[model samples]
Target: MPLTFEDLLARARALPRLGHRALLGIAGSPGAGKSTLAEQLVRTLNGEGEPWVAHVPMDGFHLADVELDRLGRRDRKGAPDTFDAAGYAALLRRLREERDEGGEVVYAPGFERVLEQPLAGAIAVPPTARLVVTEGNYLLLDTGAWSRVRAQLDEVWFCAPDEDERVRRLVARHEEFGKSHQEAVAWVLRSDERNARLVAATRERADLVVRDLVGWPDRHGRPRTGGEPGPVGTDTGC
Candidate 1:
């Protein structure tokens, strides 16, 4: 049976009850709705409340563009090595261990789509926060330092959407982040697709596979993935 949003929400609600602060990783290709799922879960879980859930995306660990240029990897900006893998793993470990014990706030960096930079201390995981939802491409990858990431996450969910919708969301994300339509298309084809393939390979390693996130308009303003979800508005590009 197809998974529903309520099913996902119920799963999230159970995380905080698991003894300690829990970290949930959402993994997928560039446009597989990882961010959307993580964001919605965090948002909905904390609705009209004291905020027990927190969100921290792995995109925040992206090495700065200047650093990428220095290492001559600017073209492959979204590649695994293009980020600080070890640092990200370390942060996850710290987040899992740190609690409201001292009543201190935990700050995480955030990525700016427009400026294409990692902003430090952008997100604060409050002391009362018991669930941390993080989304990224390489969460399930077992290669190199990326393997350390999974150990920190209590569970990782992989997002897999229809092929065409994935591409459209990816392209639209690029355009929204400052690229021209032509440039966005080119990047999606040349770079994002490769990362997508790598991420797809890691899907089998995730604890769950999520497939029904919705609301993105199709090219002709028609629904893309059958009629499961009708046209609403734009997607929250992850």
Candidate 2:
């Protein structure tokens, strides 16, 4: 049977039960809905209650544009090397330590979409949070500091939507972020596609492969997969 959103919710809800706090990693190619699914899980789990689920996206660890320029890798801005992977790993370790010791609040950096920069001390994860949902493109990569990242995650899920739909969403996302249609298409093909291929290669490492997360119910409550289309917002180009 195809996995429903409820099944994903149940799986994510069970993570915190394993220990004091659990880290859930969502990894996927560009425009595969990793951020969207993570956001929904955190929102639905917390409900209208005290907010036990906190979202800590890996986008915050993205290297600043200036740093990328200095490193002469600005053209491959979203590639794995364009991020502070080690710093992100340290942050995850800190989150686990704080969860175990019942320590003070931990602040995480956040990415400013319009400015395309990492903002420090932007997200606060309190000790009350029992589950931290972090999503990124390279969480399942088994090389370099990314390997340390996978070790920290309790379970990692990979988003695998239809390839054509994913590409469309990627192009649209670039346009939404202030790029011309032609420019968006060019970037998607030249830069994002390369990163996407790298991300796809790590799919086998995920504990779960979600092939239909972008689907939704119709007016009659029928399940639809990759039939709906629109802007993906923060779901892509992260």
Expressed as tens digits, the lDDT of each residue in 1-238 for candidate 2 is 6666777778888888645789999888999887877887787788758789999999999999999999999999999999999999999999877753547899999999889899999999998889999999999888899889988898988888779989998999899999999999999999999999999998878888877444554323455555652112112211
Given candidate 2, what's the lDDT at residue 99?
51
Clashing pairs in 1: none
Name the top TM-score candidate.
2
Could you give me the TM-score of model 2 versus the true structure? 0.90
* Model 1 lDDT, full chain set: 0.82
Report how far residue 215 has shifted in candidate 2, in Å. 3.9
| RMSD (Å) of each candidate, 1 decimal | 5.1, 5.0
Q: TM-scores for all candidates?
A: 0.88, 0.90
List the candidate 2 regions with Cα displacement exceeding 4 Å. Answer: 217-226, 229-238
Error of 2 at 36 (Å): 0.5
